[model samples]
Target chain A: MSVTYLEAIREAQTKLLREDERVFIYGQDIAGKFGGAFKATKGLAEKFPGRVLNTPISEDAMIGTAIGAALEGMRPIVEMQFADFSSIALNQILNNAGTHYYRTNVPVPITVRLPSGGTKGSGPFHSQSMEGLYSHYPGVVVMTPATVEDAYTMLIDAVAIDDPVVYCEHKYLYYHLKADALPKESFPVGKARIVRPGRDLTIVTYSAMVHEALAVAGELQRDGFEIEVVDLRTVKPLDTQTVLASVARTGRLLAVGEAFPWGGVTAEVISRVTTEGFQLLDAAPARINAKDTPIPYHPNLWSEHRPNRKSIATKARQILQE
Target chain B: MLQTAQRGKKSKKTAPEKPASKKGQVHERYVEAFRWMLTARILEDKLASLYRGGMIVGGVYLGRGQEAVSAACGIFLKKGDVFGPLIRDQAGRSAFGEPLLDVVRTYLGSVKGPMRGRDGNIHRGRPRENELAMISHLGAMIPVMVGKLLAKRMKGEKEFVGLTTLGEGGMQTGASHEGLNIAAVEQVPLVVVVTNNHWAYSTPNEREFACANLVDRAIGYGYEGHKIDGTDLNQCLEVIETAVKRARAGRPPQLVVAEVLRLAGHGEHDDASYVPQEMKAQPFAQDPVARTEKYILENGLLDEDKLKQMRAEIAKQVDEAVATAQQEDPPYPREEDWRSMSTDELIDKPSF
Candidate 1:
């Protein structure tokens, strides 16, 4: 059966519900036949009656309750309608849930599903990439699943984790990325997957940017210069060893992401590589991120605003020449 | 100790008339409530001492004047009920089943304690022991308790109810509004108590909100609103018990804005110069602890000797707890622990 990225997420949740009686899904309009805002939880409510709950339109309450349930030993997966709206519950997520484990030695096993990244005309209030912001905290685990397989596997892993996990699943990849079937067993979380192997330069990216990086690599392959692309499955427990090892081989680095440039995942990756593996790099590590502006409403402005294959390939060429 | 009269600054508005409580029969249950309140007072008095003596590095917050409200709620909540106890609810926490040693170890920042020396004294609770811990963000715990109660009900724990506390000043926060609104919409078995102490730090009742009483806001959320005398332990328990029963019966959530008095400064730091002298004496004049003591004496439940014995025994317990906590080492999170403690043991199973 052909599996879409969104379908894989649903399937993974289905598996979790069937396997663990403690697992449940909670969100606004995610119950009964309506599925969810994005239909990420379609059909499961029928299968798991009381487990799939539709909460009131209160983001703070949704997250706060999920944390309380997690503390009570129930695994709750909360779906924030839009990634941008997650700011409403930041106090509960960043302060309460994140600090609970460290402060009280009680693990809050909650997976907050954030439908992240920009979509055409999604505007500032609907579109955001918040993995970097959550990763800045001490106790949160940030997971960005790039592929359908990773989406399926990583979600299950997130619920199994003892700490609160911010699962930043890209909105763009929900239907676009597809695979023949879900992985029976996936790689352990926090390990970067090398999408393409090359010697010219290493492009470290995650989520939607992984696809763009791969596309850039394919286009550059015609010129006989091999490009390496690494997909970070999880951002917080970043696979620095993989990034450094790839950079060690390529000697050139280009970190890319769809998030804002200021203090973002791209900045974090570049900072680590430059500071820790300074001698391994032949040139200064560079990164391509979205312009430091709120995501606009128009498709043209949005297209130019984020880092695409065109901008990434151009930056790669400049860094290769250097 | 500061004289009772000098506790809080008096407000321009006069205190509400005391509720006509049941006259002079202290039941066994009321005696237990008094004991909890007394324990809380003794513990807080020790905490203040530790703060003054430099034994406690963090600031001390006590529910000195509001023990009746806290102990009443704590005593009424049954086994399946989940509660989020605030900084001023140690009596509630104790009554909710948290051991006295856990309280001492938490405040002392003992390395061998449940908190592992990570959090301060007031931020401690053992959820594993059925007590939900609270953070400094006031009104944040209201919704958390709602969620906990929802989970419990969904898991077939049908008799489960929830209790959460907030101050009058904290009632203005968006989290509190959102939490109460959802609890009403969902018809969750939740009881939210707003301790209307008439001041949000230095801001008085008039400046705190335009509403006549904080409990009236419950009307906007479509729930039954209550404004009870927080100083009367018997009246407070009777009101809360009805709400608790209504909640357990799957009725809509209840909003209780209990009028209490903040007997001490917000923390050990503030001397409460902002509170009017008249307002400060009001709580002392209507002190719940003293009132309960009077009830026990008038009803022949206990004489002065018995009360003194109870106080002395609690003092000994507090002293021993402090002694044990002091011998324990302070928490020191090493570099290795920081690096290795990235994820929990459950997720990091295959540790490659």
Candidate 2:
């Protein structure tokens, strides 16, 4: 039987709860049959007993409490119902959890699961990719898993991480992505994976956008071009070496992301490649992201707002020709 | 001297209690709380002077008027219990068992402090010992304290409570509302002490909140509410100790609102000329340090000679801590490790 990306997340939590007594899930509407907003925590409350708890609709307190629990040697997983709402808890996440170890030598081992990326009509508030926002802060590890295997393993690795981690699980990838079975092992976090390897051009992306890049690679393959797709599993400790090596082989780079175009993961990737791998580049690095405006509600506008396979192929074609 | 004479006359009119066995315990507790208050007062006074003399960097926030309430918040907490002290909580920090050296070293930027010279002044705490180093955000520590208690509860630890202090201004923050509500919902043994010092920085109560009293918020948050005269040591000690006991007894989270006035400016950098002279004449503006000293003398908890000796000893301790901290080297940029993340593998190597 196949496991969906969402089930892989639930399975990771199940494994963590079974193995470590220190592991506990705390979030709003995530306990006792309610499961979660997306049902990512379906049946976890019953299985773990008191290990899974429902919290008040308090994002600030959710993260603050997680930090406190982490300080006391408990690994807490806080689920923000949506990535947009995490803005309310940014102070607690960036200042409290992010700065704790630097100032006091106390590592806060808390994983904040953000249901990120845009669904068809999620609108501005519900549809947002916050990896770049969280990655801007120090002491936080930002993970964006694009596959079922990475979703399961990286979540388990996120909880094992000593520093605070923002695990951005794309809402769109919940059921759309599937795998034959959960993998026994996967690449560790902070390492990028080359989903499709080629030599003509490199398309670097993560999360839901990685699939879009892969689709673009397929579309371009019908032509004379061969494209390389590198999935950046973790955005913060970006696998610059893999990206640079891919760029060194392909000589062209196109960074695509679902987040806004303004200084996000796409921009960060292109900046790093241009700065560190200037000699490796045969053409100027390019990137494609969502429009600078807020994510729209209409499915047609939303489709156009975010980078898709068509837009990624168009951008990739231009970079390859250069 | 005139104020002391008037207080002495008032003490004479009231019957001085002989130290019975039960009263002796109460007296000892009062004296212990007073010692913390006194030490905090002396240390902050030195810090203010050093700041004025340009010997210290960063802001110096003094708990000049709110010592009674601050000290009471920490004094009742045991070893296993957690304490989250705010900017004006040096008195509480001391009573909660934080070292004077930690305070002095942080202020002087010595690398030997609890913060390792990364954070300075009131932001110092030993989290391993359940003392949370507070960030500048007000009301943020409330949720942290709740989480600490929740973790302890999950670990099957019992009889421990977590206490944190916030200002009247912090009571209106969304963090306070959310944290307090969550604590109540989870039934965590947490006590949140709000010291209504009449002003949040320069903003008065009228500008900060519309509630008649901050204690009214406790009801909405499902907390057992109590109020105290923060300048009065007897009331502060009695009310806070009771609130803490109720919380430890597994009662709903306690919210103790103490009424006082911030006698000093928000920080040493602020002159506080914004405070009207009429407000300064108010009873809540009375210095908790002097009031506690008078209460000790009035109740015969300790004699004038012993109080004098305690003050001298505390002053000497403060002086030595400051000297030792000043003699130690500040963190050198070249020698600083500067790694924020604890995971060595996750940390990115410096490109330069």
Candidate 3:
């Protein structure tokens, strides 16, 4: 009952490692020496000495190795110290790992997890929600977990996938959550979960945004505005049906995410809903997302860049009024 | 954005043994390697012709004088021993038993082509025969091969090792450095084959790097390195065998620098007009396929008539594969092939 988001992710790794000898974990500062910066893999290196690898300071090599290993029937889990640094291995991600399955017609079951989103006062390089750009690559699966249950459950689901996956974990969400006993068995990915159900307005979000949407919903509910929070667990192959169903029921939609406003994940959601679920929407989909600028170091500036409870609440009200 | 192509697996009927190689089989092992080399030479010559015409789009870096490297390597490689491919591995692919017609069809852009005609000559590889496609980006395959080698080790496959090939120019690139460094420290079961032709495009080896020979660089990286005459198929074959043996025995990687000559230009598109006519002509004197043919003919290993029969067989097979490939259609994938996939779909089942 005391499963934290970090613990759930670790439990998923442990379970997968124990069950599947093909699955392995590797990255810089990982392995037994450092346990990773966030302790996401504290015991993995010790538990599985040969499987857990600590590599040189080369992101391209790390990703390329994962792809190569995956090609040869071994599932590799690669961790980017931070999400934004993932750009260094962009070629490997898109060209090699993502396309290896298409080119060779063999599934390259490699998983890349990035400690992402704005937190820790680490400016530009550390705090980018690159969901939009990543979603553009074909043959890759992207995951963003909100609840601790999802954090644990989504990884099990990810492990079962035969293709490459880009799993985004918010740096802030690691220790700031708790859930019931995490599942050690297989789970499903690609389906969006309804985190907090409401009938007045549907709030579509994921990762840390789910928490923000729920917090805002709690404050707005006392004042008579019910909000449905939808956790879009996977970005690519988006759960459009859940979004449309929620939008149809609520008649108002607000996409909340800690990502950019222009051409962001929210934009994709709003675009899809408007095209298909146009008549059902009482108001045009409103996006309560991060500002279209690099995350600032200052706390308030960082807060300003990302959508918070007040912002989510304001957007929910605006949609209701419309 | 130089993107890597993606592929998913499918269960298919076991591919039949290629008849093209069977036609050239005269019963002896080394002679069989010579016949395979003849097939590669003819296929490569045909590809060179295709590039000269308007058919094959991206020209290939021909591995002409280095036929023995391909001939011997093709014979020595066993099941699960992956060949990472040199810029000139079209021969190696044929030797490793990538159905000769399929190999020819790949060069001809046929439907039966390795990548379903989606991949040009520069991007060819197959998992079935354990020969990775030819990657145009030099030295990029080194680290990838090492990683695969490590994976095989992890899977408890002791017989599996990686053979990564590159040009002499690749010795100077960061790819060679990083790849060798990682393979060295990790002791990845890999045989980094540096096919030193003594030139990088128009630049000579003296101007390219400080090291006199590419093998010296590997020794500095803390691995045993050997320099072998690329023209001698026996030498190259024996070198790879020793490296493979050492990798399996000591569980450490080795480097084999195949010293050959760039018998032609950098690619089929580039005429060797830039190369000093002397260098090209010198290496041509001891053409690998020719040298082996002479070895078999002069030593009474096989008469000229027998060699003639092998060449004729190789030519007929190449012609058939080329005709089939020319008639084959390009790959047609679904719309999802052009769109992003979800984690579940990427890992489990995405409607490909």
> Highest DockQ among the candidates is held by which one?
2
Residue A125 in candidate 2 has what lDDT?
A: 99
Q: Per-prediction TM-score of chain B?
A: 0.87, 0.92, 0.83
Per-residue error for B88 in candidate 3, Å, reads 1.5
State which candidate, 1 or 3, has the greater lDDT. 1
For residue B179, give model 1's deviation from the true position in Å: 1.8
Question: For residues B139-255, could you state the per-residue lDDT of candidate 3 as single tens digits?
Answer: 666767777877988988776667777777877766567667777667777777777777788788778877666666654676666678888766666566666665655434677
lDDT of the candidates, in the order given: 0.83, 0.89, 0.75
lDDT string for model 1 (B1-352, tens) is: 0001111242122222333345443376688888889999999999899989998887888888889889977987877778778878977887887778788888888887777677788888878766887888877787777777777766777778888888888888888888888777667788887788777887888877897667767757866666788888877777777667766766567777788778888898788888887886674337789888998899788889999999999889888988999998887756225432336432222122
Off by over 4 Å in 2: B1-21, B350-352
| TM-score (all chains, Cα) for each model | 0.93, 0.96, 0.86
- lDDT tens digits, residues A52-79, model 2? 8888889999999999999989999999
> What tens digits encode model 3's per-residue C-alpha lDDT throughout A1-322?
4888999888889988999998999788878867897888888988987988888766776777776787788888988888898887776787776766566666678889988898958888889988777887777888998777777877777767887778998888888888767755533567788878888899888888888888988998899888899988888768888898999989988888787777867888888888877899877778977887878998968887888887778878888888
Against the true structure, candidate 3 has what lDDT? 0.75
Residue B318 displacement (Å), model 1: 1.4
Model 2 lDDT on a 0 to 1 scale: 0.89
